[model samples]
Target: MNKINELSYNIKIRNTLYFEAAIGLSGNSFLLLFQVFKFIRGQRPRLTDPPIILLALIHLLMLLVMSLVASDIFMPGKRWSDSTCKFVMFLYRFFRSLSLCATSLLSILQAITLSPRNSCLAKFKHKSPYHMLGCLLFLSIFYSSISSPLIKYIAAIPNLTSPGFIYITQSCCLVPISYSVWNTFYTLFTLRDVIFVGLMAISSAYMVTFLYRHKKQSQFLHSTNRSLKSSPEHRATQSILCLMSFFVVMYTLDSVISYLRNPSNDPIFYFIVILVGHSYASVSPFLVLSTEKHVIHILKCYGRTVDI
Candidate 1:
């Protein structure tokens, strides 16, 4: 009786929490898509920092797909075929690594974009956008391929839960991956996350510090005029901070929680952690839309048309 109650509780946690989070993720991801379209299709269709929002929307779509796979995996007696399991695991790892790399790219690009004259990144400021796009594509596809081996962790199990429902319960969950491989995964991925997080932190700090100093230097030019000057760059810095807060900080927590979870011992925290992992996709778009005036203008235009 106690075991059944516990299992039921775990199932409820998986379903309810995941459903709620999924709803938010699905809605916000579509909102981002709509906003992006509005900006691109509006009268003056010049996107500001196109790469950042583009990558974010891609990450959001991937998150929505991953959430659905997670829903399947959490089913108590469900069993997956070898190929099905492999694909799901592969996509999950691939998308996550892609998100991390995209975020790091956003930070580094912003750093280069905002660097002052004679700064170290100034030389690369005029780097070809075509080359940058190629590199990002390679990173998202080729670099992320390294996680393909993780599919070995997934295995199929029989439906021993209920004799009556044997026909319906078709798939199984991942057995605890081997301790050595699992630990190695944790160590290696943790190092990867740390490296990217550090890069983003340093880049964001440099941008914000440069902008603040630039504002202060304005005061020196005219001693009697002490007001801080506002610039588009200042707004860019704020947007970058908002984007980083969502991607870097929330991502670190999600990664740590995912690494430490013991699915057999506790399924609740796993669901909760997974929820946090996807929330970045759902919430980050609001930041992007709010920070970019053009997108809001388009939204307002659309709203007015609707009102009429």
Candidate 2:
């Protein structure tokens, strides 16, 4: 009975992962293809469009890699070889880092776009694409240089029933490292997360301030008018703010759960952590697309054509 229950639980987890991956892949793919079509058609892209494209692509790849990892983690019987485990995990980590950097850049880009002409951030408006590219390059280098230890430490579990192996997944485990080494890597990873999250928070605050000042100014100018609709830039900023807020919440929850987890190697705990960690990648495209009028317009046109 116990064995049967465990099998059922694993099956449920696997199904949940499959569902999440499918939804994320479809959303991200649609967003990506739409943006690509815009570029191909020589349409003028918004300042935030490039980052959105990059972000969609990043999340798409991350979800794909995550789906692969989930297959190894939940499927029983055949185990991933050592090389397969290392490669898949390394890809996941690489894309994960890119996601963080891209999100931070997205928020900052939105803030720059919404800045008043005389504001300090206005100067960055024209140079945002270059800056974003440079930042992503730097971040990729940083991840390769600082987080490369993960490649060394991650290995396929030689024996599933071994007593000394640390549980990462059913097939992969982290080999033991010295306390000093572990502390060094832990601190570096934590610091990286802190820096990106801090950037996001700062950018979000700036956007909020701009929106508040704009609202007050508009109110004073058009006294007693209650129907002043927000501008496109304002709507975009709000969307990015919402996305950043959700990302921070998910990040904090995942971090806290990881920090507080016991060594009992609970499968449920692992699934929760994974779900929290992947939530942003799986959900962000919809958050972004919700504010994109272009996608809606295109869909409407397509529907009309279909009905004809």
Best candidate (score: lDDT): 2
Query: Tens-digit lDDT track for model 1 on 1-308?
Result: 99888767767766765675566566556555765676567733222354565566666666666556656646544456767766766676777777777777777787777787888877877766445666667767654655565567565554454322211112545555667987887676667667778888998888778766876777767653223333545566677778897787787787677667553534555666667877776666667557566666778999999999
* Model 2: colliding residue pairs: none
**For residues 140-161, what per-residue lDDT tens digits would candidate 2 score against the true structure?**
6775667877788888888645
Model 2 misplaced stretches (Cα beyond 4 Å) = 128-131, 160-162, 223-230, 297-308
For model 1, give the RMSD to the true fold. Answer: 5.4
How well does model 2 score by local distance difference test?
A: 0.82
What's model 1's lDDT at 243?
Answer: 85
Worst 10 residues of 2 by lDDT: 223-232
Error of 2 at 252 (Å): 0.4
Candidate 1: regions farther than 4 A off: 1-50, 73-78, 128-130, 141-145, 158-172, 176-178, 222-230, 297-308
